[model samples]
Target: MTPNAREMSESIHEQMPRLLTELAAVVGTTNVLTKPSQQQSYVQGALEAVTDATVAVVIPHSLVALWRVINICAAFDVIIIAQAANTGLTGAQLRMEIMTGR
Candidate 1:
C-alpha cells in the first residue's frame, strides 16, 4: 500500500475500539458488526471480482443514527461505503474498504 494508505490503516486499527464504541452509542452494539461472517452480506456485491474489505458494517435504523454515523466517520476520516438493499449490480456500493453502513 501507499505510505498514506498504510498510515491510515494503522490509525484505523488503533482507533477501532473507540470508534466502534462511539458508533454503538449512536446506534446500538448489536447493530455494529465487525465479524466477517456478519458483514458478508453488506460487503458482497453482484460482481464476483469485487472483494470484501470493510472494517465494519454499521446498521443504523433511523435517519438520525445514520447522520450521526456519517459525522463520526468524517471525524475519523474513515471511508464510507453506503449500501441499500444490497442489490447494486455494478458494485458501486462496495467500493471502499473501510466503513459500510445502511
Candidate 2:
C-alpha cells in the first residue's frame, strides 16, 4: 500500500470510536478510548515474537459495553483475538490456546 492508502486506512480506523459509541449508547464520553496508550497490551507469545499488538483496547465494565464492542467489530468485518491462558512452555491441559475469532 502506498502512503496515500495508508493514510486512508488510518482515517477509517479513527472512526471506530464513533461507531462503537453508537452501538454502546450507555457509554459516556470519558469511557471511550480514542488514543492507543489508553488501551492494554495483548502479547503472550512463547517464541519471543515481539508481536506489536499496538492497537487500542477497550475494556468493558459491563455486559452492555462488551456487547456493543462485539457488535461494532462484527459489523465492520474486523478481527477479534481472544486469549484464554498461557502454559508458559508446557502445551498440556490446554483446550484452546487463543481464539482468532471474528
Whole-model lDDT per candidate: 0.78, 0.51
Q: What TM-score, computed on C-alpha atoms, does each candidate reach?
A: 0.78, 0.45
Name the runs in model 2 displaced over 4 angstroms: 1-14, 20-36, 43-49, 83-102
Model 2, 30-85: lDDT tens per residue?
56554545533334346444434334444566787778777776776555554444
Candidate 2 local lDDT, residue 20: 59
Clashing pairs in 1: none
Per-residue lDDT tens digits for candidate 1, residues 1-102, read 445666767877999899999999998999999998987777776555666467788999999999999999999877776877866643664544345322
lDDT measured at residue 78 in model 2 versus the true structure, 0 to 100: 56
Give lDDT for model 2.
0.51
Error of 2 at 74 (Å): 1.0
